[model samples]
Target chain A: MSENTRLRPGDTIGILGGGQLGRMLAQSAASLGLKAHVFCPDPNSPAFDVCAAFTVAPYEDLDALDRFAESVSVVTYEFENVPGATAAHLDAKLPVRPGVRALEVSQDRLFEKRFLSGAGVAIADFAEIDSQAGLDAALASFGGQGVLKTRRFGYDGKGQIMIRKPEDAANAFQAIGAVPAVLEALVPFDCEVSVIVGRDLDGSSASYDIARNHHENHILKTSTVPADVSDATTRSASAMAEKIVAGLDYVGVMGVEMFLLRDGDEEKLLVNEIAPRVHNSGHWTQDACLTSQFDQHIRAVAGWPLGATERHSDAVMENLIGADVDGWQSVLKEPQARLHLYGKAETREGRKMGHVNRISTRTA
Target chain B: MSENTRLRPGDTIGILGGGQLGRMLAQSAASLGLKAHVFCPDPNSPAFDVCAAFTVAPYEDLDALDRFAESVSVVTYEFENVPGATAAHLDAKLPVRPGVRALEVSQDRLFEKRFLSGAGVAIADFAEIDSQAGLDAALASFGGQGVLKTRRFGYDGKGQIMIRKPEDAANAFQAIGAVPAVLEALVPFDCEVSVIVGRDLDGSSASYDIARNHHENHILKTSTVPADVSDATTRSASAMAEKIVAGLDYVGVMGVEMFLLRDGDEEKLLVNEIAPRVHNSGHWTQDACLTSQFDQHIRAVAGWPLGATERHSDAVMENLIGADVDGWQSVLKEPQARLHLYGKAETREGRKMGHVNRISTRTA
Candidate 1:
């Protein structure tokens, strides 16, 4: 990559996704006098509304991606599933922050587990499976219950299945299309938490306060800042996030989702996954912190100094999924709630339409 | 006017004028899922980049203005010099918040002073000057010093001249094109302050805390929130803002700038001027308040409940002019400073390139 190091205010950032994340990132970039050029295949991309420029094209089209890369000073993807080769291609022309390796590891569950486990991080007990026999053997090793998950393109509980018994192993594997997958024993964690960390070009890094998350049907419903975890757990989460980012040689904001195992005296955090881009769990930071995770990510990608992660107020961010957005007027009526709605024309079930960050000075 | 009073999330807002305030207002509207359609004569307007749609046409182009007005649910303006006839034309198609009265009263200095005075609001003693001889007459009416100002289209101390000496009156009048003007006695004030108020369609109103201001070269340099004023002064300012908005039967946000005079036993606030739209002095609220001024304005115009204007933290907002914006790097390095840059392609001296809102929990 041609490392021009730091980017100035007028620099253009090319975003690889056009969802609400990209829309918000574009808004943040605009605030800093930076322009955003979003490249997405969807004609109805919400990000197009707020960005200075955009192109509608498939990611597999290398020539189109190159033209986009030529226009922007730096490139960043809002999702981890950005093709590694595409990022590498952009990197050859300009800086692609968080690097291709972060994408490579996070996009595949097996690679993510191997990378996290190798970095002295505690993750779920897992074994990879490529065939029916492999699935059976892994299920036996897990003893009781284990999840069979396809190693790629899984989110919001898709591409995964739970095997509760030996007989259910083959059915679970078949249900997953018998693809390359991982079988993992589920841990009884007290709560799910995530820490969003930003690393600058010089390797200086900082993490925002932990957000304790709640999921409805395996989709994130709410994220509350000042997670109910103890101070020691927060310290451990911060340290682990720092270590993981350094290990990947990553720059830009990365979210670390973990399961907090509350085994009495042996309270520990087990790494569930790594999202090498801004995560929904950190949405509360937009209202609670001095700098939002989106702004921090933009700053990191621009090679600017990392902003403070201190929480200025207590906040709870709730996702407005599909019909939940029907309550937008009520959300608007709430004096302390800050409403952010993605300008999406469609409102499909299970789709993230918007979110509200309710802010207060009262801490947990 | 359509009289579709309550604007839902998906509604469109059409804005007149396309400067930084228009740009910021478009951005705020986007956050709430409302699209902005801007109409301005400048093709290079900053507001165009962030809005969903735009019409580049002169305000006198009645057909173009009507078409633009037809596409939006409501019409609001960023600058009061929105050409009264053009505003009236738009109002004929849809409800225009902070209506024609706000534009009429604020666009002309004489009308503004008269309206405020009629509402029992305190203001400087002033007289109208239609010619050079009229300037001399008004000068004599005021004992020593006065400011000669054009009745219309004056901003940032432009189209105005300070007549420090009696001999300067005719020259100042000629300098202002001998246009219809207002010559006001220069009050010996202690400081300048402003308050931003939002009034909803239902007449419910709220006001952000007073902003203490400092000017350099007739341009705003900085505004500190929770202005160092006595409780009575703050209350008086709030009451006056509410009274003015209610008197005009206005909706959306209005900024009232005042000159504070220190008396032997009383502190007085004299109305200097009123901005019908979002004002630069209220920029601090973006970082310090629960709801930003822009957001409050959007909510008010949308006919949703007005947001809380309570200040969450103390803040000092500093305008970054042409050369001052070059210090963006240094500002970015300050962890707690929130930077907002207007995306103007060129950097001209005295141009408002951006501003920074540095926030802290410490109150006044």
Candidate 2:
């Protein structure tokens, strides 16, 4: 890819995925006087409603990709699973920030771990399990409970199996369909947290406040600012995110999920995974901060200077999954809640429909 | 209109007018999971881009109006200029919150003054100017310079003219096309300010902090919250807003513009005008307060309880004119400027293209 970067307001931002993340990114871009051109396979994608233009086509359709490139100044994805060939197609034309290297590492669990380890970042104990025997050996090494996950395309608890004991190793491997996977020892952490970091084309970077997150059935439920972790832990988590961005020369909002582990007398953060796009946990920034993560992503990809990630108030963002959004009116009555509903036609079970952020002044 | 207000999340909101207010309102409604269907005469309206459904027919089109009413659960307007017949049509078919009373009282300057006076609200010295002679007579009665304003369809500085001197009255009258207008005595004031108040269907009301405003060429240039007015002035202004809401039985966000005039040893506020729907001056609430005017609007029309109107911090919202949005990158870098762009297809001279809100914690 060429090292040339050019973007500006009024320019169109081409997004690869059309989910809630894409919807918010488009909303943010519109707020900046920039137009978003969403490209996704789902015709019912929520992002289409907020964007100025869109094309619903398979990611591998080179003709559609070309048209999308012609319509936008820069390209970014809302999800990491954007096919490599698709990114390559757009990169060959206009600039694709958070480049292909970042995608390569984030798309696969094994590659992400290797890259983090190489950067001297702390992560969970793990080993690549490409075969059944390899899985067994890895499971034996971890002793007790370990999770065997497919190396690629796994998200929100998909493509993983838990090995509760040595006796269950074979069944666990079989449960994962015997695919190439990575074995990670179960992490005993105090809490799950994430830090959203942004990088510009010029290598500048900034991180938002650490968010303590809770998940139900592997999907994010609520994210609260000023995670119950110590200030030093936040610093370490942000440092890890910055190091990852610098290592990958990444641009745009990248979410680094970490586990706050208590190691005897001290507490440390362990890098669990890296998401190369805006994460759901950062949604509170839309109401609590000066610039939202979506706008930050658009700015970074467009080669604009990174915005300040300082938050103005304490906030909690909760996702309205499936039928939870049905009570939108009651939530709106909360006086302090700022509601966001994605314009999706169908609210099937387990689907993320919208979110609400309740903001309040931080107590000293 | 039946009091059968059971609007849920998946409900459709029919919005009248397709200007930037409608566009932003639609965006906010969608964020809360509600779909917006915009009805306007202009086919290329900016609001069309972000809405799930749109009708490009004149407000007088009964067939279109019937279809629009059948499609959405509730109806509201973005501008105060909703034709009497248009509001009547929607009111007969479905619930139109901030109903015909608001439209009837606000669409014309004469009616607004009469209504406010009847409601026991204080206003400036004014009289109807049906002819050029009427303008001269009002000037003679008021003593010095006054204002000549068209009674209907006037906004910003469009249909209003300042009579700086006795000799300028006829010229100012002629400048405004000598329409059926109002002549008012200009009251000397310290500054102009406004309060944005929201009322639910059940009559519960909430008012945002008074915002001190600045106008250039009769157009709102900027608005700052925790207005530089005294505490007493703020209370009076807010009470005035609440009074209008109760009197009109208004549901949704209404902007009440007032003037702070100094008396002997005290400052008093005089109501200048009433906007039946969301007003430009209240745009700062989106970033500086717990509930934004747009989201609050959606709540009101959806039969939801009004959100809190608490100010989160001291804030300044600045409008971006034709070329003002060009420096969005610099604005984004400010760490405090929160940008909001109206997705207009074209930016013409003196057009309100977008706005940015800069928020900071205020020292008590």
Candidate 3:
């Protein structure tokens, strides 16, 4: 778009996916006096309940996409897996923030690794594996151990397998439908962390405090801010995030997951992956900082000035998976716990029902 | 209403009056997984843009009210002047939180003063007046200085006149449309302050920190939390708020405005007015406290437990009236300023277009 693409308060923002993230982004838009129109196929999408308008149609429906684009000044999505064709279609009509290129680069694992490496971002070693034989060959080169992941549509430990032993690789490619994939040597990292960065249309960028993440069952369980890393490590992580966003010409908040490796106090970071939208790890910003990632994302997509990312308190955000949300009553009673429910109808196993942020005065 | 009238996630809340207060309430409800359906006559209501569903019909439209009541599990209002008949109509169908009596008492200044005095709460001395002679008589009894206010439907210093000297009261009665009114003794002591209290269905109550308010052109200009009051004054203000809510059998958030009087080294507080909804003074809680007044109101009306009311930071909430909202860019650039625009289409004079909350780490 143009440098003067800033939206006024009453402008409508079209969101492509209607999930918890979209639900939050819509709410943030409303807080700033802007309107949000969510588009999703699911009638029961949580976001539909909070937006000003919505269209229930598949991404492939060009007519619906056209109408949605007409109603909004800009378009953005909650998830990174938005079809490339869909983003291009909307981009042809209105500005689609983070641009279609960000989606194209982040959609395919091989492309993502190559782009990161080209941009001078530190990442793990990996190779293309189109078949079981190719996977086996790539695994042997990485000392018989690597993560075999599909090139597209993988999330929450799905579409990937850990091939630790020879037997573990047997039919691993077939198990993933033998799709074009990438195999990367799994780094023995000290901890997992992420930085959420917001880049404006004018190339101004701001990054929130790094969050040290923890996973259970390959699903994110908790994210604690003010990551227990050295000041140099924090600075390095932020620089990498800025570099990645600038590399993609990104114009919204992006979550950059990284692996923090420590070799006797000599810390290093490897870019793990990039989400071209708000990520679950950054939810703590909602309560711990003056501006949330959702707010920052909306501001960026609207071409408004980016907000300050300084966090006033230390926070730990824990996801309420499945039945964990049943304890909302007790959580409400906790003085420092800020609960956020996704308004999903059912609590299926492993589904992200909600999350809670527990905060305390900064000690460090 | 039953003893156990708790509303679960995914339940719909019907909100009356589609102004900025309702807009913020709807947004807060969404944050906790509840759907909000707003009802108002104006097609241009700002809250309509944020709610899940909205009815653009007058409050007297019984058929529309029935349809709206059918679509939600419970009902609440953002303003106190929600026609008693309309509130009574919905209360018969389902729970109308803060109940009909709370609305009735607060709707009339005479009734409100009587209720507070009956509840043994400290309040300003006042007398009812119906004619120019009556207003003149009441004014004389109060040292020829008082405020002649309409008993009902008065807000933002509207429907009231200050009778300072004899000539100021010449046409004051006719100026207020000759409505049945109450003349209150003019308070001349100190600062204006307010307390927001949330009472749950179980008769449990919580009070936020007292806020010292500043007004311009009879409209609220700013509210500073942790009002510059002594501990004794603070405790008194909070206790008065709790007493008022309990006396009204209030089951939602209520704003209580008071006048602080300083006598030598002693501090005194007199009840000024009561707002049976989330008060503007409490907006600071959205940024400085774990649970905002809007969040607490939703929880109360939903029959859920109340969250903590402790503020973690010092906050000053300033309303952006009319064209003041045009400075949003500068506000966005302010590191500690949190901006909230009401999405109003026009910048009419005296209109509350939005607000900004600036916070600092608590020092006292």
Candidate 4:
């Protein structure tokens, strides 16, 4: 799709990998007079609850993919781990956004790191490790302080292990089931921050305010906006995001996770990871900004002009993890809190149940 | 529900009436992480495409009502025309928001006028006409310039007739099937405006920016925000809205249609009617305000604190009547325009197909 030929209201948008992100994306699309048709394997996926149409078939099914492509004008995915063949299958029939380049970079950790570094962006020190010998040599060169992570299908602190000593490498490899991996020097940082940025097909890019994120048991717990970062640092972060988007020729929202490193007199930044789709940290935008990340993503993918990224108020977004949702009534009673609950059938420990976004003119 | 017992994310909300309004409400509820179970007689209602669950049965089906009430935490309706017994049926089992009082007042034109007048809100000159003689007397008082509208089941110019001359009263009454009706003196207003106001259980109310409406063939064509009215007139319009809400002890968003009449040097406002649910004129809020009417309705009925009522920018909302939806793709190309499409299966003339909300910093 060209930037001039944007999808309008009543146009069908096909979303891949139906989940909460897809659910929110569909809702945003609906609010703007667009229809979303979710295509995913799970028949009970939460995204289907809000979308106008859905296809219950695995991503690998060519017939299902064809039917999904034919049903909507444009297509985008919620998750990056979709098999390369699956994306290729959908792309052949329709416009698949965030493009193949973003998917390729995000699917493999080593490739993602190389891409970031090649774009002249700051990232953690890393070394590729394909076998036991390669891991041993990388560990010896690094003074035995690094993390070994699988190259694919890893998220939320999974498929990785810390290595403090030489003997720990074997168990770490075994922990990841001896999958193809990379070893990188762990950066000791003060806090984690993520920038959710969107790039339209017309090359117009916009970024939301960076967020100071806190996580518990590898799951996001809270995100405070206005990120406690200096105005100069925030500008630099936004510039870095723009560089990444321009480099990838990216379309739609992408999350760039960074570490705020305090080195003596100055605060430095190091890229940690990149998410090809909307990030959990940017959830605050729904309540705090004029246009939300979900809406931005849909607009970018549909080849439409981007909305203003200006925020309306200071915000604090808190995730409702498992029993955290039990006190939903109390949270709702908080006069300025905007609560969002995913209609998940079963809520298990560490699962993302829902979230509350409290907006206040009162700022810290 | 009490103020402290406001609903949070992951709660279930029951919606009565499975039409476009219900579909939009269900989409908003889902965005807030709440599940919606829709109850309507038509199995093929468009809203069923998005809701978590739905029951297809007559409004008076006690068994279905019981099951619906048992499944949802709160019950709200999309239209005011819900049978009085049906609202009572759900109200007896669960909390029905906007309450039966608001529904009763809006369901009948005569009751709406009485309620507005009793609340000290300005209303058009009107009289209840249960017989032909009553209509003749009302017409005589109006000097034969009046409108005869059915007390019940009237919307979008249906069940209404204009009496231009004394001799036309009989045919005008016959046009409405001679049902119980109300005859009102037709005010030569400069413009039509509406205030979409929300009232929480705590008696707190919030009103959206007033919209100046234009109608063609008795069908709403467009609603422009930042209505060209004096500040005093705007204040009175909003105050009248608050009074109406307080009178009904309402707990959801309601649309108050008003006439902008210029009498000598002063502009006066008159309450035309009350829509006890989200109105098409309020569709612009989805893109132009901090909180949308559907979201505000969900928030209010769920006993949550209302969101900010701030309008983002000056906006114009245009309804895509009939085959105008065929040009949806072209409309999407406008950067400032936000399109919203109802998931109706077919497009019929005079039907509310969808709407586009165009927000710009510059006023038209």
Candidate 5:
């Protein structure tokens, strides 16, 4: 897309997913006086409740995609797993930010690792494993301890198993349905952190403060801003993220998950993964900063200038998973807590229902 | 309505009037996981671009009103002039927050003044004027200096005439089309200010910081939070707002516009008018407070607990009238400014296109 592709007010942004992220992207689009048209197969998608328009059809349906594209000026997705064909189809029709290349690379683990390595960013050592013998050989090279992950469609610790010893590898390939996979030498880190960065259509970039993340059952539980990492580590992580976005010629906000490893008296950072859309860890920006990650993403994709990434207050964002949302009443009563509920009808276990961002005055 | 009228996440809120206020209210409802259905006669209503559902029919259309009411759990209005009959029509089918009484009282200046006086809120001296003789007689009593205004449908300096001298009354009656009016003694005010207060279904109330206002061409130009008033005056203003809401048994956010008059070593506040819905002055809350006026209004109308009213930053909110919105690009580049545009298809002179909230750290 050309640098002159700025969207005017009242223009509709076509979003390719209809989940909470899509719901939030729609809200952010509305704040800027822009409209949102969500496209998702789920008729009951949470985002359908807040968007100006929606197309409920499978991503593979080209006719439906054409109709959706015809109604919008630009397209963006809320999930990185948008089918390559879907992205390619829309890319041919209109501008799709972060582009198809980001999708193609992040969709597979092996490709993601190679991309990070090629961009000169530090990452865990990994090897593509298409067979049981391949996994064993990679494990032997990594000293018998590594994480086996599917090359595609894996999220929240799904489609993977840990091989700590010879016995632990039994039926490991079968456990993940024998899908094409990658085995990576696990890096022992002090804590996991992530950086949310936004790249505008003009190649300018901005990043938010690093957030220290904690997980439960492999799902993100909480993200606290002003991460416990040293200033050098924060700079290193931000530089890595900028490099990756620049390397991909990416536009819009990207969340780069990283591991902060302690090396004696120094700190080392490793790129864990890259999310080419707004991530859960950046939700704190909604209440603590002038421009939220969602808003920044919309701005970038619309060819507008990126908003300030400076957060006025420190915050801790906690996701409301499944039954945990039952405590919404109490969350509402908390003085510093801002509750954001995704309009989901059902509360199945492990489902992400909503989130709360607790903010406080910034501390030096 | 009962105190148990709390709306669930997926419940829809029926909003009367699809202007900018309704648009922001719809966005706030979405944030809380509630759906918004906007009802308005204008098919191009700005709120339509943000709401889940919409009805393009006159407010007086009972058939459309009935159908619109049927699809929502609760109803609320964005404008005070929601025709008592239309409010009564919806109130009969479901709970209409702020209630019909607020609409009845606020729709007519005569009723509003009388209600304020009856509620023991300090207000300017005024007398109803139904005829030329009455206008002349009332003008004589106010030291030949008062504002002659239509008792209904007057806003932003419209439908008002100043009678400063004997000659000023020549075509004054004919100027306003000789409608039923109110003649009020003009008081020398130090400045204009407003307070936004929210009262829940259970009768509990909370108020945001007072905002000092400035007007240009009779339209609100700016509202600066932490109004330049004594501590006692702020307390007095908030107390007056709470008293008025309690008197009306109001549920939802109410904006009480007041004139701050300076006396010997004292600050006196008089109720100028009451907006039974969220007010433009409260737009500052969107960027500075945890719970914005729109969010508080939705929470109250939905019968949910009110969020905190404390502002994390000091803010100055300025309305973008007509061509002022053309400066949105510059506003977007400002690090501390948050731009909000009403999705208006056309920009006409005197139209309220949007607003910008500029914030800074609070200082004691």
Candidate 6:
């Protein structure tokens, strides 16, 4: 698809994976007059409740994948764990966005680090570990203080462990089931931030303001806009996001997480990771910006013009994880609060149930 | 069902009649974590696309009605023309909102006018005509100029005819099938306006600011916020809406259409008609206010806390009728335009396909 030839209101945009991200993505697409077809193996996926059409099929089923590609104008996935073969199967027939290369790099920790470092983006020191010997050597190089994370399928602090000392290296490595992993020195950063950027079909890009994030038990708990960073630090974050998008020739929304480290009187940015889909840290954009990150992702994949990212208000977004969702009544009654709940049947420990975004004129 | 009891996220809302209105209502329900079940005889209903469950059965099917009432916690209708028997059947089993009395009144022109007049609300002069003699006498009393309309099922100028002279009364009567009808004088009003109000199950009420409306070919063309009415006129409109709600014991969002007339030194409000559900003139609230009419209706029916009805921006809403939807590209490209299109398979002349809301900082 090109800039002039774009998907219209009735066009169907197929989404891969089914979670809160897919559900929110489908809703945004519907608001813009487009239909959504969700393909997932889980029958109880929350996205099935909102999409116009859905097919309950696994990614490995080539016949189902072919049928899905034929049914939609373009395909995009909410989760990054989709096997490269599944994406390649659909990309041969139609457009699969964020592109195959972007997906492959983001799916692995080592490749993501290399891609960023090669693009002249500053990143924490890292080394790959394929064996027990490699893990021990990498830990020693980082002075026994680093994180050991599985190369694939790691999210919300899962499939990862922290190494605080040399004695903890072996246990942390075994905890990840001896899988391929990467070890990076834990930076003494002051705060965590993220940039959500979109690249259209023609490679034109736009970015939302940096979001300051807080984590509890390694899971994102909240994201506040007008992050406590200098204007120069924000500029550097946005520039780095654009560089990554161009490096991968990405088309769709991608999230870049960074650590804001204090270097004496100056602040420095360190690339932590990249999410090749809408990120949770940017949920505040739904209430604050002219167009949300979900809308931007849909626009990019549909080959439409990128929407303005100008935020109308300052915002704070809080995640309702597991038991926290029981307090939904209060969020529902709060003024200027927009509440969203994923239609999950059961809430398990550490599972994300929903989120609430509160907007105000006050920036702090 | 009561003040202390409230519907939760997993609860299902059953909607009667499948149209664009039902589609929007279902979406709003889903946004607030509720499931929607749409029941319509037509298989191609646009609302079926977004709802969790759908039953394709006519209202006359007793078995289908029984199953539907059992499947849902609460019942609401998109159109007021729901068969009396169908509503009675559902109300006997579950809570049916805006109840049977409200439906009966709004479905009949004479009944609505009588109820409004009895509640001390100002309205246009009208007289019920049971026969040809009565029609002629009513037209003559109104200076030989009046509108003859069927007491039931009249909308968008349908099932009605204008009488400019006594000679035209017979033709007008025949045009409406010579049924039990009402004659209303064509009040020389300057402009049109409407108020969208909500009544909770507890009898607590709230109203959005009046919306100024414009119609083309008797179909609603546009609605803008901050209506051109004085403070006294606005207060009078709000009071009239509350009066109608209390008179019917309504428990959902309702639309009260009125005429703004210049009566020499004073501005007068003449109640034109009341819609038992969300009104097209209130579409501006979708972008301009904290809570939309759809949200208000769902909240009221579910017995949840009514959302704040504060205006956050100035807005103008325009409907896309049939071929006018071809300019969707321009609307999509424009900044601050939130476009919504019903997933209709085909568009016919005079059919409402979708709408666009444009917001600005300027109040005028």
Clashes of each: 0, 6, 0, 7, 0, 0
Best by DockQ: 3
* TM-score of candidate 1 on Cα atoms, chains taken together: 0.97
Off by over 4 Å in 3: A1-4, A362-364, B1-4, B362-364
Interface RMSD of each: 2.1, 2.4, 1.9, 4.2, 2.0, 2.7
Tell me the tens digit of each residue's lDDT in model 6 across A1-364. Answer: 2223358788999999889999989888877778999999999998898888999998999999988988899889998888989998887888788778888999999999999999999999999988778888888888878888999999888888888976777667777998999988899999999999998877789999999999998899999998979999989999999999999988889999999999887999999999999999989988776578998999888888788787767789999998999998888778778887887889887899999888773322
lDDT of 5 by residue, B1-364 (tens): 4335789888999999999999999999999988999999999998987788999999999999999989999999999889888988888888999889999999999999999999999999999988888888888888888999998999999999988888898778889989989988999999999999999988899999999999999999999987979999999999999999999999999999999999877899999999999999999999998899999999999998888898888899999999999999999889888899888989999999999999986532
In model 2, what lDDT does residue B327 have?
Answer: 71
Candidate 1, B24-91: lDDT as tens digits = 99999999899999999999988887888999999999999879977998988898888878988888
Sort all candidates by DockQ, best to worst: 3, 5, 1, 2, 6, 4
lDDT of 3 by residue, B31-103 (tens): 8989999999999999987888999999999999999999999999999999988997888888898889999
- Candidate lDDT (C-alpha), each: 0.89, 0.86, 0.92, 0.85, 0.92, 0.87
User: Comparing 1 and 4 by DockQ, which wins?
Assistant: 1
True contacts kept of each: 0.68, 0.68, 0.78, 0.46, 0.74, 0.46
| TM-score of model 4 (CA atoms) | 0.86
Q: Give a tens-digit lDDT track for model 2, residues A292-318.
A: 898899888878888778887889999
| Ranking of predictions according to lDDT | 3, 5, 1, 6, 2, 4
Model 4 in CAPRI terms: which quality?
A: acceptable
Better of 5 and 6 by TM-score: 5
- Deviating ranges (above 4 Å) for candidate 1: A362-364, B2-4, B362-364
DockQ for candidate 2, C-alpha atoms: 0.58
Place model 5 in a CAPRI quality band.
medium
Model 5 lDDT tens row, A1-364: 3335689988999999999999999989988989999999999998987788999999999999999989999999999999999998888888888789999999999999999999999998898999898888888899988999999999999988988888888778878889999998989989899999999988999999999999999999999987877888888988999999999999899999999899788899989999999999999999989899999999999889999888888899999999999998899889889999998999998999999999886532
Alpha-carbon shift of residue A360 in model 1 (angstroms): 0.9
